[model samples]
Target: MAKRQLVPTVRLRRLALELRQLREQAGMSREQVADATGMNRATLYRIEVAQAKPQGRTFQALLEVYRVPEARRKELTAILKSAHQQGWLQNTDDLPSQYAALIGFEAEAMRMLNYESLFVPGLLQTENYARAAIAGSAPDMSAEDVESRVIARMERQARREPPQTLKVVLDEAVLRREVGGPTIMREQLRRLLDDSERPDMTVQVIPFSVGAHPGMTGSFVILQFADEDHEIVYLEASTTDLFLESKGDVYRYRRQFDRLCEQAATPEATRDLIASELSGLK
Candidate 1:
């Protein structure tokens, strides 16, 4: 079996490496840093290796020990500020490490495009709908943990101003899938319509009739940051998450998204289709 994976993004890994370097510059051994920060030695090692996350206080203590210069200290702290970001989906640790980094990236994204073949996307899900969906995914989770995870995800959506120029091309089957049963599905569809109408967001559906097209391979999200030069593409699986940052790789996904968007119905038409289906749900 493939190993269970936790893929921290480049940003997180860089932070971890910086922390490790600071410790080394301070002439502190892992055990010594661990003692100074009141963290276990193994944890110190994990933090250095980018395999684990250090708590805020622990992180601050390490910085202090390293005597990070003022400007550099500010920069490191900003990276840690991302660590403090709590999205609506954070309550559950069931998300693999790599996926968690995607959440952080999502929180920071200014523009995002998603092509979903199955299920409603998280950023667009309602509380009841999201909670029910998450519960379905982790049947073994305790009721409380499910609630916590659901609340976190919902809150994540609320924490930021919704994406500027968010675009999604969803398959018609996703609307018809009946995920949390008819009632939840209906609500989910209605919510999709509501979100689509936002001035900066657009949603389109690719009708079942549009047989074979681009994006035949699962789903992908392409995020464009405020810094235009930093665009990225994210691909996820049950066990792993991949971020394509090379210009060539990112352009390939960008092209795929453009093609899928072309094959999808017009935004206004998609909203109308959703509304008609929602009425049928009633």
Candidate 2:
């Protein structure tokens, strides 16, 4: 209804998958459904692929055509209604599509498993630390652009308002990288300590002693939703980011993260290590 979401949210995609499944279960081809609903085949395809949002009438028609159970119909109808609502970073034309897509995924993830080999977890970064990191990494960026990106990074922390369940496995190198120099790094470490204390957050660090582990490959995040059984693996890079929804891809990353977690220091030990790093920031 609202110009059809330019970038479909995870909720929308989930609904889209369900809609396609419902049609299949009902033994109706896209052609048949389009004919029965009197909707264009292309439009129906778009809805199934999550490129467009079906109007209420069209959604109702599809449900009727599929003979969806009363209970499931109400559930799906609720999802359809909410999928069209605007969400943060859902249409950020300024950012790379991959970056924006991660925002959508992160916002909806009820629980996140993040393994970082080079830097502090983005969502856990302090404002000053984030500014330094962004500005330093992209020296050619305009001041306004730098500030805008920093704001977006800060706003992403809202997901932790009720303290989102976040389990972080950070390499020892990230703490010693000195992104914003000593002062900023100290503040960043302190914030990580604070965040680690939160009931919903679990921050574990892989000390340098665990040399050559699986996470040394790079950073990745595994996102899980409350309403969905599947998981999404997100990987960010300098040139392009990736979203892997395939079961094999997801399973491999999940296994990697599991191993990384096993290699990390205990929460109590992590706090001690952070304290040691903070003390060394001379």
Candidate 3:
């Protein structure tokens, strides 16, 4: 008999769903819950969506406010505690602190939609590419630091099954930018072509000809779980990361994705564009 694999996310996501359901059952808005527990709405939002790991006190306060029964509180708290312990990159602090939780989330995500307006998405980057990009950005990081980050990124790709769905929308400028110079950039684009051929992957290019598109604001990733929970939107900037799980905000992002898709070349055409770009690098 095969051993059961523990997916902490499954537990955390369940907790989140339960939390949200309880609030809904009580006919309370997020603001109402905030008023009840004296917790900020943003914090409550993250907790209910499993985007942030709530402290034990915070979870208890949340349960108190949501009126969760004593019978189920123990089980839910245990689940939350266990999920918080399943950190794969605990020893590797080389990666950005802001990215640690996101990396863990990526490991458990069933579907990931990534849009890169500047550089390649971390999940798809090769070791050399990862090293080059990291080193270039953080000149003070040690060689060992850069390598560990690369190893962590590579590990994300070694999945038993490819992500159930991967839609990567790359801006034309990302392809044109020489992050690691011509040779590395060419290989990177070729790798994109290779990865896109996988059954679970879809790659699209937002061509320069499109002029401007929905993703013009910035690069963001919208992750969908198989459990039909609220979608998560990850927005990044120069110094901060934002995780949005509000249904309204998620819907707005979904609309932006639709617009980006509309403006981008078709998947088949995207493959051709990537091929043409690869040839240009030769």
Candidate 4:
């Protein structure tokens, strides 16, 4: 069995599902796989459940048992290789485990759909706005802790990773909401306008006229991965967070996001809204 970790990564999650499907496709039970490979059934179970990392030798045996084609073998090997790397929150010990997982999801996602009703999305926040928001939302946090989180958020924005595509839906209230006072909010709105100009960034707004849209319940992020069939719906809270992976749950969130997008103003209209907010700011 390979070594175990506290949290299973996205690659590990996909590898587990793929391996299970491959085993099923081969019409071999775990016992049969264990018997054929001369490995323990417990080890096979652990590997399939992602309780343990699939070591090179272990996957080599698995590919042999399943008779995987060379091309598929290489793909699986790539996932295995990346599974050993650390999560994106390597330096932020102050970050909660669940929040770190959110960062991990963001780092690995091929595309992300985000909807925020209360404030600007973290990825698009200016430094001062982020600092103010964090400080306000987490009053229990020490000044140092707030600064650490602000730095972490800034680092996340700096990551020019595979999520070259991002679509954001914001409520009009977010534009009027005050964080870090007028100067900070003005800069943040300006940044949003600038970011929306990028070819891959799509920004839309749900005005007060929209009246109780699908995202009114709360904010969420839909993460779509190109490498596997795995999709994750992330719901964040003040303390703990939820990662919805079941097909039904993820499907509902995806549908909700689609509805939100439909109700949101166009990108051009959203820029006008931001400009209006900036003008109102001091």
Model 2, range 52-137, lDDT digits (tens) per residue?
87899999999999998998798788778788553322333325443545776676678999998888988999999999999998
TM-score of each: 0.68, 0.70, 0.67, 0.70
lDDT pick, better of 1 and 3: 3
User: 2 or 3, which is superior by TM-score?
Assistant: 2
Candidate 1: C-alpha RMSD to true structure equals: 11.2
Question: Model 2 TM-score?
Answer: 0.70
Clashes of each: 6, 0, 0, 0
Estimate every model's Cα lDDT from 0 to 1: 0.76, 0.82, 0.76, 0.82
lDDT by residue (tens digit), candidate 3, 1-282:
996533325346656666776789888999988998888999888877777677888888888887888977986787677664422222233225335457655655788888889888887787777888988988988999788878877877775266467888889998888888888898888888898798988888899988967788889998887645646677766555666666687789888888888888998998899889889885
Candidate 4 stretches greater than 4 Å from native: 1-11, 14-95
RMSD of each: 11.2, 11.7, 12.6, 11.6
Model 4 lDDT tens row, 35-114: 99888899888887666787789889999999999997997897788874533222234245445556756766789999
Q: After superposition, how far is residue 39 of candidate 3 from its true place, in Å?
A: 28
Kindly indicate the candidate among 3 and 4 with the higher TM-score.
Answer: 4
lDDT of 3: 0.76
All candidates in order of lDDT, best leading: 2, 4, 3, 1
Q: If both were scored by lDDT, which would come out higher, candidate 2 or candidate 3?
A: 2
